[model samples]
Target: MANLQLKAIKKSYDNVNVIHGIDLEIKDGEFVVFVGPSGCGKSTLLRMIAGLEEITQGHLLVDGVDMTHQPATERGIAMVFQSYALYPNMTVRGNLSYPLEVSKRPKAEIKQRVELTAQKLHLNELLDRMPRALSGGQRQRVAIGRAIIREPRIFLFDEPLSNLDAELRLEMRIEIAKLHESLGNTMIYVTHDQLEAMTLADRMVVLRQGVIEQVGAPLALYHNPDNMFVAGFIGSPRINFMAADVVATTVGQVQLRIEELAIDSLIMTVQQRLNEGEKVWLGVRPEHFVSADGADCHFSSTLTFAEHLGHTNYLYVDYDQEKTLVIEQRELEKHTNGDSVTFGINAQQSLLFAQSGERIR
Candidate 1:
């Protein structure tokens, strides 16, 4: 296992900068994920670490050795791409041993490595089968096995599960997680899927257009996002944001106007400085909403739609100003398209963001 470090790394195409100076230190054997929307530079950053893309500036170090200018073959890294990229005519054994063979390992060593990788990946029974004969998941396994046979110090996966079906993706995700545990190598995975990053990463780096938005453990980022962008991006069914004007401010709490709702006063603890009459956004997660009366704030609205998902339902409600809010409820009773419903939330769980989208607390 090896630690990877990137210092002031950058990339550009014809002087149009894509990756703005990024610095990170990845501990040995740590599973780090780079997650963000497309065109956010996650993939470009991964490729730079893999030595596939030339660094426009700054340095990259692996195992404490500078490798910024090294060739991909000398980086001691293996990558599994979204496409399996397997050779059509090559058998599974051939595909797995190809890298070792090119490295000029002894014939016996190549055979042994291939056999071991096939066994680890459970591809022993399909060793002689061509790529065309294997299913999508099996082909993906072969791609991974090829990487494993290389005995790389670090592993890089770039959306390796994107091409698979949903069920297959889940199965492969578990398999990859188990593989990491068994191998204990430094692995960096890049994906746009938040759930995958949340479940697979020991730590995650969230990026926005050529910039790092936040870095933290999955639950940390989910519970306490550094800014509004991260707060909205990291969760499923996203957090709801409402426009409000600060009505009152104290050392520990502030009151806000929730529009025309009869119960509009919402008090939230503030960790940052804010004066009265300042406009701010109120953020509340779908699950933080409660149907009972014991809440810090309460509001009534007309239900516009409800989606039943077996155990729970997502209710979309609209107020008079056309602002829509989503609420999650269990055992939802007597709710329809035009029925009025009241939802409440605890003030401590609510998030406040300034006009700049920076979290106030």
Candidate 2:
């Protein structure tokens, strides 16, 4: 196990910059996930950590030793890519043992490590099967087993479950989680799927446009985002943004006038005082909306769409000409398009953001 330190890490292509200056510290044996949308440079950053991509600037330290210029082999890191990358002709055992063989380890040791990896990944029954003969999940297991046999200090995964079906992705996700628990290795995973990141990461690094936006525990980032980008990116169904004008401000409270929903004035406590007449956004999550009965605040709108997923229901309402509000309901409600629906907003749970997308305390 090893800890990593990235200080002013950066990457560029010719004159164009991709990864901006980033500074982060990953603890030993911690599972950290790098997550972002496409073109966010999450994969590029992971490749840099694995020594696959060269760093254009800054220092990378592994366990207090500089490894920025080290070769992949000397970095003591094993990587698993989105593609299986398994040899078509090699059997599972051969694939698992090839790395040790190339390093010229003892024959008995290689055989023993291969067996242990296979057993750990539950690939013991598929040891003799070729990559083509195995199922996709099995192939991924073989790929993981191949990496496990190396017993590197750090493990890097670049969207390893992207190729699998939903069920297989879930299966492999659980398998990977279990593997991390058992081995207690330092792991860095990159993915565009926030659900995967949320489930697998001990802490998540949310990226955007080659910049590190926020890094924290999954729920911390979800519940207490640093800005609008993070608050919008981290949650499912997205957070609702409505225009609100600061009608008044006091020691620890701000009175908001939400003209969009025809609300005259509503008061909520805040960490900082806001200037009166300043325009801000009120953000409410879909799950934060409750039934209108006995609610602190409420709004009425016409339902535009509805999605029922048995355990939970999502109601989409037309907020304005440019936006739609998604509300989550625990109890299933039968509603058709264009029907009038009322939702209760929990003011205490809501968030406020400046016009520039920065969170306002």
Candidate 3:
């Protein structure tokens, strides 16, 4: 296991700076995930840690040793890429033993290591089969097994599950979690999928445009995002954003009124000062809206469509002239499209952000 520390890590192509100065500490035996959209530089950062990319100006320390200039093999890291990278002509056994053989390990040791890795990944029975004969899940397992055979200090996975189907991805997620528990090695995973990032990471690093947005546990980031981008990016079905204006301000609370979608004024607790008539953004998650039955509706809209996902219901409502609100319901009554529906949200459940797109917590 290895604890990694990156100090002012940066990357640039010619005069174009992609990764700005980034500082992060990854603890030993911990599973950390780097999550962001494409062009956000998550993969580039991962490659830099693996010693595959040069650090423009920073230090890379693994297990208290500086390895910024070390070669990929000398950095004690094993990476499993999006593509399986398996030799189609070679059997699983051959693929597993190749790295060990190349490193000049004894024949007996290589054999033992290959069998042990296969057993750990549940690929023992498929050892004699080529990768072409294996399913996507099986091929991914083989890729993982190849990484495990090295027993590297840290495991780097560059969107390792992106190639599999939804069901296989879920299965492989469980397998990877179990594998981490069994090995207790430091692992770094890179992916744009927020669901995978939420489920697999002990701590997640949310990146945007090659810079760190927020770093915390999955639930922590979900419940308490530091900025507007983090709150909107982490949640599913997307969070609803409404333009709001400050109507009044008290000692501990501020009264707000919707700007675009005209609505009743609501008071929310605020530690930050809000000037009267100042514009701010109001964010409410889909799950926060409750069914409005014979009561005042804070949000009134026309039902555009409804989607049922087994236990949960998603209701898309068109509000005002252009705003669309998605309401999440648990036990929703049947309603046709174009039917009028009203939903309400508690003031405390909503978030306030400044015009600059920063949370006003």
Report the lDDT tens digits of candidate 1 across residue range 210-254: 889999999999999989999999999999988888889899888
Query: How many steric overlaps does candidate 2 have?
Result: 0
lDDT of 2 by residue, 1-361 (tens): 9999999999999999999998999999999999888999999999998899999999999999999999999999999988989999889899999999999999999989998888888888999998999998999989888888899999999999999999999989999999999999999999888889999999999999999999999999999999999999999989988899999889998888888777756788888768999999999999998888867778899999999999898999987677888999898768899999988876778999999999998
The local distance difference test score of model 3 is 0.90
TM-score of each: 0.97, 0.98, 0.97
Q: Total clashing residue pairs per candidate?
A: 0, 0, 0
Stretches > 4 Å off in candidate 3:
293-297
lDDT of 3 by residue, 1-361 (tens): 9999999999999999999999999999999999988899999999999988999999999988999999999999999999999998999999999999999999999999998998999998999998989999999999999999999999999999998999999999999999999999999999878888999999999999989999999999888888889999998988998888889998888888885556746788999788998999888999988766532336667899999888888999986576688889898567689988878868777888999998898
Top of the candidates by TM-score: 2
**Model 2 ranges with Cα > 4 A deviation:** none
Q: Which numbered prediction scores highest in lDDT against the true structure? A: 2
Worst 10 residues of 3 by lDDT: 291-300
Clashing pairs in 3: none
The 10-residue segment with the lowest total lDDT in model 2: 259-268
| Ranked candidates (lDDT, high to low) | 2, 1, 3
